[model samples]
Structure formats: structure tokens, C-alpha cells
Target: MSSGSGVQPKVGFIGLGIMGQHMAGHTLAAGHELHVYNRTRSKAKTLVERGAVLHDNPGAVAAASDIVITMVGYPADVEAVYFEAGGILDKARPGSVLIDMTTSSPALAERIAEAASERGVTALDAPVSGGDVGAREAKLAIMVGGDGMAFEQASPVLRTMGANIAHMGAAGAGQHTKMANQIAIASTMLAVAESITYARRAGLDPDVVLDVIGTGAASSFLLNGLGRKMIREDFAPGFFVHHFVKDMTIALEEAARMGLDLPGLELARSLYDRLVSDGFGEEGTQALYRVYNAIHA
Candidate 1:
């Protein structure tokens, strides 16, 4: 329903992880009927306490709501939630909307859209960027792909969770856009790590260096935000290293499918793979700085 329609759609949210929780929180705060489910029930505790209805499963949430949004972890998880028995596609009523906010395979997004259409349901692949901070502030950049009308209907709900939201094109376009975003981020993260490492190696204050160069030719969101995090050595999970690796893998796989050779992306993936192998997968991606730091030390 459009914001001006005076129709409040019942909203369901699945996957209450680092970003999902805040997004779902924003949806609830906007006064819609909010239903939620997560594998780890405890993660839904605060939201439930805040008047959200916590269901036993994804299907239950789907059956109960008018519009369902899933911000699950992996493509596999997205598959299970939508394609499994008693899943969203199985239980959602005809004419309802399904939005998968997970960063997943473009092919899978297209598959979900086709399956939903067959059942008279509208599906959109609307993956997001902006990490935990963006979600918390309701300032995420959402890239959506699906029917134009469906995007219009979902805009009001999407607005609660993001500041910059766009309907990219048909099914899979949103995911393709996200892959491009990840590819850019993959290499930028490496540069951010290396730049800070070099600054420190030369005995220059990284914060001052940041202040000087942050607005110059080398400026970027990752360089300014994650760069500072790297300088402070705060490796918390704003966006987990493992998750970034997963995005990079998906981008690399897509590139190969399209006959592209992205060497910079490949190099970044290798470094992040090492971080995961070294048991730092749970840390934020800024922890890449530690790898450079250790090498310089």
C-alpha cells in the first residue's frame, strides 16, 4: 500500500540478525501490524516485547501478514525460507508481497520471483547496503527488483527501513546491483586497510591522515567509516567478515558466469578468505586492517 493510501499493511519480518532486527524495529515503529520469526528465538525477544508478534516459523509469519520481508543470511537460508514446505511462497495469501532483502544469487532471486508469480504473489529482490548503522538509523540504501506496481505498493513499508530506495528493474536486477556494490566494497576495503596500515607504518597519525585525505580524491564511505573503525581496532560485527566473504564469493561467481575477470575482487577475496581461515570470520570487515597491521609489525 502506498503511504498516502491510508491502508496499513500487515508486515512480517524473518531473520533477526545484525541488520534485520533494526529494520524490523523500524517497520514496527511506523505503526504497522508487525509479525516476526527467527531461528534463534532470543533474538526476537526485544521486538516481541515491543509489541511485535513472534511466530514459530517463517511460514507462520507469512500466512499471518500482508507483506513479508526477509533479511536472512545466506542464499541457502533464503531458499529454505521461501521454497521449503510450508514456506512463505507456500503459505502467503494470493496478492500478498514477498521481499527478500538477503544478498543472494541473482538466479535465485529470479527463481523466487517466478515461483511467487505462479502462485499469484508478488516477490521482490530488495537487497540493502549501509550495514548495522544504516539499519539502526533507518537510512539504508535499498535496491529493489520486481514489478513496477508491486514496488509502488511496497514503497511505504520500504521507506520505514531505508532512506535511499530504488526499484532497479525486473527480477534479479536488485541482486545484480548488490553484487556490483559488493565488488566495489571488496576492493575498497582492502585499500582502506592498506592505507591505514601504511600511514601507521610511516609514523603518521591515521586519524589526522583520514581528516586530511578523507575529503580528497581517495574519499569513500568505506574509507571514511570503516577506516576509522580500523584505526580504533574496533572489530565488532557491524558487518561480519564471513558475510562480506559470502558476498564476495557470490560476486566472483557471477563474474565468472558472465565471463568477467575481476582480479582486484579476486585478490580481496583471497585476503578475506585468509581472515576467515584464521578464525576471524565473526569479526567486522574492518578487521582486515589487522592482517596488514600484523604483516607490518
Candidate 2:
């Protein structure tokens, strides 16, 4: 609860995948006594070498830390980590905090909050954006939803991993906000890919076009960041294509629940689905360019 100098919380981090690895590292570097768990122990090697305590399971991590955070892959993974036998909710001490940073279901976030409350633990759905680079640089934008008091209690620890952090509302609000984020990004991704494809077909240097258009109203994080990655053919998973598809699916489902229609998001999802079908799921979202190329071919 203390945010002052030299105060370090006992923090437990589960999921050491792409962005999680760097986020955990930032927490450890900020002086927290870090406990970590990953399904693949090999992924935690660098953090363990830097003095983090590695645990065999989520429950172990929760048992050992004052605050426990999970940044896993899917809604099912989220449910398993929090509700399975020997899970975090089963082992986390009373009054401890649980933060799920996965872009997951709003319903699931509400479920976790209710379960955590029943057991005297505080829960926050604190999904993040800014991809692998942001995680590595500790500049992620963290959107949090839960009790206001819990958000305040976790602020300093969250600060270690993000530059832009906001408490959206209660329980499921964070996930809803994240769904909104994904919806907006969905259309922009297609646009960015199409724009680059257009520039390339016109025989204008795409990089030069990026320099001009990226400074105009056409600019975006996708344009300035992932655009370069696309231009360089860097299809590595800063944020994977499959993952973005999952996010868009969640957004579409959520929108449907509210009796809304989003044609652009639907189109983006269809293109990403094609990418997945063609074996580019593990590639970065910048692989949207491949879809454009395939279409124009």
C-alpha cells in the first residue's frame, strides 16, 4: 500500500509469455520481491536469474505474494488460473489483490471479481495495450476496473509496468474498455495495411509515404509503430494475429450483445481469419499486409 521510496510489495506474476515477461521484469526491477509462474519454466529463466522466485503453479505464486497478477492468453486460461483446483483464488491469502491483465471477457472479469470478493481478496480486471515494445519499455497503457480502493492500492505497483493507467469503472468495465480498444484498432489495422499496399502499388516508396502520411491526419500508433514492422517484413509477434482475432471476436460478440452492428470490425475479423487459415496466426498483427497482398494479387 505504500508507494514511497524503498517500499516494495511482495508481488506474484503468472504468465511469462511475450509481454508478460517484460512486465514482470519491470516489477522486479522496481524493487518488488517478485514470484513468478509460467507453464513453460524455460521462459522464466531470465527473470529467475535476475532474482525472481520461480513457482511451479499459480497457487504457489499467490500463496507467496501480497499481490498476484495474471497476464495469460485467453478467457479459458483466465478461468483456469483463477478457478481451477489449486488456483490463485484457492490459495491467495485473505486481503491480497488479484489483477488479470489479459484482454478477456467482461463477464469473466465480473465473475472473477465476485469470486475474489467472496474469499476476501480484491480483484481488478487490468488489461493492457502497447504491445511487446511497450511492455519491454514499461510504457503500456493499463485500463483497470474494480473497486476504487483496490485500484488505489495497486497504483504504485501498476505504475512500474505502465505509463498510462486509468481506473475505468467497476468489475467488468476494464474488459469492456479493452473490447472498445480492440474494435477501434480492428478497422485501423485494415486501413494501415491497405494504405501501405496502395503506396507500394503506386511505386512510391512506402517508407517515404509513411513519413509523409504518418505526419498527417492519417497517423496512428498502428501507422507509426506496426507500419514500419510491416514495411520491414517483421512478422514477429509483438501482438499476434491470432490474439488480435480473438480480441476482435470478443468485441464483435460484445457489440452484438448490445444490439449493435460493426461492418468494419466484421471485415477486419474476416481478413484476419483468412490469415489464420493460411497459417499466419502466430505472426504479428502487421501481417494484415499479407491479406491485402493476397487480395490484390
Candidate 3:
């Protein structure tokens, strides 16, 4: 995806939320002409002021760029942007490639791939891990589900926003891989929060236990990052509790459909549902600490 001569890639970015804001900025900063769109117009204002062009709708952004990148929150939203009446496919050129960077359903990914292929447009499901911090620092791990040529075409733009760019088989594979990631992390996050809470209850300094435990076999990004936040009571959302809850919901559906029993993932999903039901849905997932707080308080 390297540039040839002075002609840099013309990039399109939609979904200007927290992660999207930082991501689109990277493309603009990388000297690509970024055409941008967002549901709420004000979210795109800052980037437009910085010389990124704003489109009134998704179709407008697609019509203007060679590559269209989407990172909206939900599967329906992702579909609506790409295939809705007046969506990107309606206006994009035949050869333009679409990369869905949203962590969404494998079914939806395949659906988009089929639809795009019919129109001579290539599409990939390239969901990502590494929360807001990863996006800001360009250190995200991107799992792409598409063919080699499309991956090659989209790599430069993906590289501007992520560090680990892996091509996971065919279309829908990236999202399947991402669901596996979320499922693995789900219970681990609960354990991380529960362990720290147990330590605090026993009058042991959490920092001391975190220092010791994080050095042992139990260490993870969830442990290190969430542990630090629990210590400081900084429950701000790098990844919201609501979003992880949504991811778990998707994984659970996938599991049930395949006749697989995911007990651990279910437990974590229950924990998040409790968190959301307890009115902590808007808080960062590290606020899983509040669960133990309810019992220990």
C-alpha cells in the first residue's frame, strides 16, 4: 500500500468518535487527503478545521475516496453506512475497497463481502483490539479478514492507525478472531478486578499485590492497565463497559449458534450486564471494581 511518486492515497473515514477522531487524524497527519463523515456533524468539525474534508453523508465520503474505512459502533450501523439507501456502495467507484474496522458480527462481515463483491468492490472485516490508547499511539492490533490484494491495498492506511496488522484468512475471519479475543479477555478482566478487590479487603496494599501478581503467570494488558486504574479509582472509559458488554453479547450469540458452551465468557457477560444494569454502563470497564465495592462496602 505504499505510495507511488507524489500521489498519496485518497482516504475516507467515517465514525468520528473517540477512537475514530484519533485515527482519522493520523491519516490526515500522514499527508493523505482524508474525506471524513460522522453522524453528528460537530464531531467532524475539528478534523475539517485541520484541513480534512467533511462530507454531509457516508455516500459523499465514499464517492470522493479510493479507500473507504468505517469504524462505527454496531453491526447495524456498519451495514447502514455501507449498504443503506444512499450508503457508501451507492456512490463508491467499482474498484474502491471498503474496510470495516468495527468489532462486529462475522455474519455481517460475510454479508458485506458478498454484497460488495457483486458490485466489483472489495470489502474486508478488519476489527481491532487495543482501546483508545492504542488508537492514539498507533499501536493497535488489527486483525484483517479479506484476500491478500485488498489487504495489501489497505495496509498503508491501516498501518497509520495500528501496529499489529494480521490478515486472518478470508472475509469474516478477522471478526471471528476479534470475538475470540474479547471472549478470552472477558473473564480475565473479571478475575483481575476481583483479585485486586480481594487484596484490598484483606488490608494488603493493592499496589504491592499488583506488583507481585502482575509479575507472575496472571499478568495481562487487562491486569496492568485495569489494575492501575482501579488503584487510582480512575474509572474513565478507554473502552466503555457498555461496549465490552456489547462485544460479549455478540460472542455469546455466536457461541450459542455453534452449539458451543462458553461458561467463562457467559460469566463475564453476566458481570458486565450487572454492571450496566447497575447504572455503571457509561463508565470504563475497569469500574468492574464497583462490583466488589458493592459487596465489600
Worst 10 residues of 2 by lDDT: 1-10
User: What are the lDDT figures for the candidates, one per model?
Assistant: 0.93, 0.92, 0.89
After the best TM-score superposition of candidate 2, give how far the Cα of residue 190 lies from its true spot, in angstroms. 0.6
lDDT of 3 by residue, 70-126 (tens): 999888798799888888888877788899999999999998988888988899999
Residue lDDT tens for model 2, 87-190: 99999988889999999999999999999999999999999999998999999999999999999889889999999999999999999999889988999998
Candidate 1 Cα misplacement greater than 4 A, ranges: 1-5, 295-297
Instruction: Write down the TM-score of every candidate.
Output: 0.97, 0.97, 0.96
TM-score of 3: 0.96
Query: Which clashing pairs does model 3 show?
Result: none
- Compared with the true structure, what per-residue lDDT tens digits does model 1 show for residues 1-297? 323467689999999999999999999999999999999999999999999999999999999888999999999999999999999999997789999999999999999999999999999999999999999999999999999998998998999999999999999999999999999898889889999988998999999999999999999889899999999988988999999999999999999999999999999989999988888999999989877876322
TM-score pick, better of 2 and 3: 2
Q: Model 1, residue 224: what's the lDDT?
A: 94
Worst 10 residues of 1 by lDDT: 1-10
Candidate 3 local distance difference test against the native: 0.89
Error of 1 at 224 (Å): 1.6
Clashing pairs in 1: none
Q: After superposition, how far is residue 150 of candidate 1 from its true place, in Å?
A: 0.6
